[model samples]
Target: MSQQPPAQQQSHPGETGQMQPRPRDEMADYTGRDLLADKKALVSGGDSGIGRAVCAAFAKEGADVAIGYLSEDSDAEHTAELVRRQNRRSLQIRGDVADEQHCHDMVDKTVREFGRIDVLVVHAATQEPVSDFTELSTEQLRRTYEVNVFGAFWTVRAAAPHLAPDASIVITGSVNGLRGNKTLIDYATSKAAVHNLTYSLAQHYMQDGIRVNCVAPGPVWTPLIPSTLGEEKVEGFGEQAPMGRAADPDEIAPSYVFFASNRLSSYYTGEVLAPTGGEIQAG
Candidate 1:
């Protein structure tokens, strides 16, 4: 794959099939060693991008999965197919994560299907970039926080009672969260709130032996890019990073796998693992 994607654009909440250079989100070449054998996971936004890769990786590791997505039925079905191919059960629940009831329903359906939740991945997010802060609208700000921050809160709260010791909750933050983005004002702020939520939740769940962590990645070739960013911005998406290129969903997924597996991250919680393509950040 090339380091840069050609200039392209798509409607909001883009479909993976419509992407010019399809995202590498299937985890196709990866092999599993039953790291998540018999476990069950619920991944919000599991239809595409990082969420799609995470679902594939978890299935390969021997876990049944329930995918929560919005209106992207085709993408969600394709993701479920990937999981089913691994002989793991997959349940697709389509609804907007921004809806409080929907978030709760996502967890409820996953528990009903799998009987319990071993992993909860809060990866559903929305972003729109504005060249100037003045162009950022109140509506956009509310929507961004509703999906990126509020949804994460609702999903985790609903899943809390069902999570036991050794259960893991992984929130998807962004490099922009640690260091702000000039154009992505609302999105960056929402993600920063999410990172803080991971820290707070980790402390709250520590006594119960449940781990909470975050994976904040740099630019990754995902549907969200071409859909939300301007055509020009999508052209050289991750060039600002020290690596001068964006990551593939495949490259970013292993971080989620590590956080999901207790055997690998037993002593880690409230940690933010940033795969920023060499962009260094200071605490």
Candidate 2:
């Protein structure tokens, strides 16, 4: 147990610096192949959780990453330092992903820093508690859409113009998109939109050689769980999943790698990789 209660500090992506047990960002045994060598990529919410893992992985793979996060400056700076230690550059920016101006500026700043964009990982999301549909407030629905739907829209729209033909996009969805969790009606519906968004963008952009896809992860061990539910509920998170264990962030980052790498997944697009630990049935 941590000395401090899990501080409910409002934070942005990649901000695991303040968590009791800092999120296991890079796996001890993992090695890299320079797959993303010389590439410049962007990761939203890259200060912590799955986004933080992605940033570390990108660094190991020889890419300088731009981390776009919310308000967690300390966490974002820590993530940047870790990336720099891996001999790759890290640009940490703090802003709301829901802002269209910030969305455009994120891409602009990345291009200014790195000259061009090679990959865009849309991973930041907004979620709220909802028990019943009748109880859903219009503000809640709109805010959810702004963060989940419009956020992806603006990031991609901003980055699209500068990307090379072989650019890749990996949007983050949720397993709830697969099985509608009633309590997450708004959040789940937003994820569903991302699922469809990936396909639409993949089809429309295939001719341009830019692949768009999504990864839907099950109940992984992340702050989102503990922050939403108290510390007690966090323990049994993955008991229901077939694997009977919550995914570590590293376990989830590989899907992004598979999607981002041209050597491994060049022929793939409009795809959904469910890292849900056998929760999805075999086709």
Candidate 3:
């Protein structure tokens, strides 16, 4: 593997605040009506990007939040600061989702802090170079799977027992999962597995009063773009999309909001909400 220093420094897992063009995290113009009033949410990868937007949405909807992230303390603090602006309680847990034990600790800590869990959002993922297939080393593949698949699995496993009846679990999938990313084979494959896992879990847990669903986003301009892609690629991202722009994290976040609130989508489960800005294909 060759190391070429990124044009804009990397925010490893990802962040919205530091993105080259800065993703719109807040739905500044959107008004809220307390959709998730008094609800409790536990979100993974909640430090920034779509996860950060979702955190803000949860807070705006009147839900206190417990967030988990992978070693991004500053980013996590920034998210918590934003959550607090909405007047909701926020707890930031720093740890790696790839570790099963860490996942357990996150859930346990959330319950200990918040007393119960009403919604669980798995929004963490990993993707390498979208055009460098042959360069994906075995270690890279393992790391990708560990974060994207194994991490999600451990999250659900740990949170299952703590999930309240009628609780919803939203896992973040990607358009790449639906339409394979040749540049991100391992990452894409893991997301595909997440989609299937969401479906299977929904059906398997339907009778248990748990709803497992997925949200697949396309072309959202999060910090990952500037970090993972070369400088040139980041310059004109949204231009290639049919919507003529990379999605703002705020735009993609409402899907999670819809899936999280049982009142809005009580009858929906095991399904996916694709927020791809008119992208015909999904992942």
Give the alpha carbon lDDT tens digit for every residue of 1-283 in model 1. 3647889999989999988678789999999989999999999999999999999999999999999998899999999999999999999999998999999999999999999999999999999989889999899999999999999999999999998578999999999999999999999999999999999999998999999999999999899999898998888778878888888899998999999999899999999999998989898
- Sort every candidate by lDDT, greatest first: 1, 3, 2
Global lDDT for candidate 3?
0.84
* Candidate 3 worst ten-residue window by lDDT: 1-10
Over 1-283, each residue of candidate 2 has an lDDT whose tens digit, in order, gives: 1122343433323235445555566644568898888999999878777888888888888899999988877767877887898899889888988899999999999999999988899998877666568898999899889989999999999999999889999999999887777877999999999999999999999999999999999977666665565445555566678887677788899889889999889999999999898886343
Off by over 4 Å in 3: 1-11, 14-17, 130-132
Q: List the residue pairs that clash in candidate 2.
A: 13-45, 13-47, 14-46, 14-47, 14-48, 15-47
Give me the candidate number with maximum lDDT. 1
What's the CA error at residue 173 for candidate 1, in Å?
0.2
TM-score of each: 0.98, 0.92, 0.93
Candidate with top TM-score is: 1
lDDT of 3 at 237: 69
After superposing candidate 1, which stretches have Cα over 4 Å from the reference? Answer: 1-3
Q: Name the lDDT of candidate 2.
A: 0.83
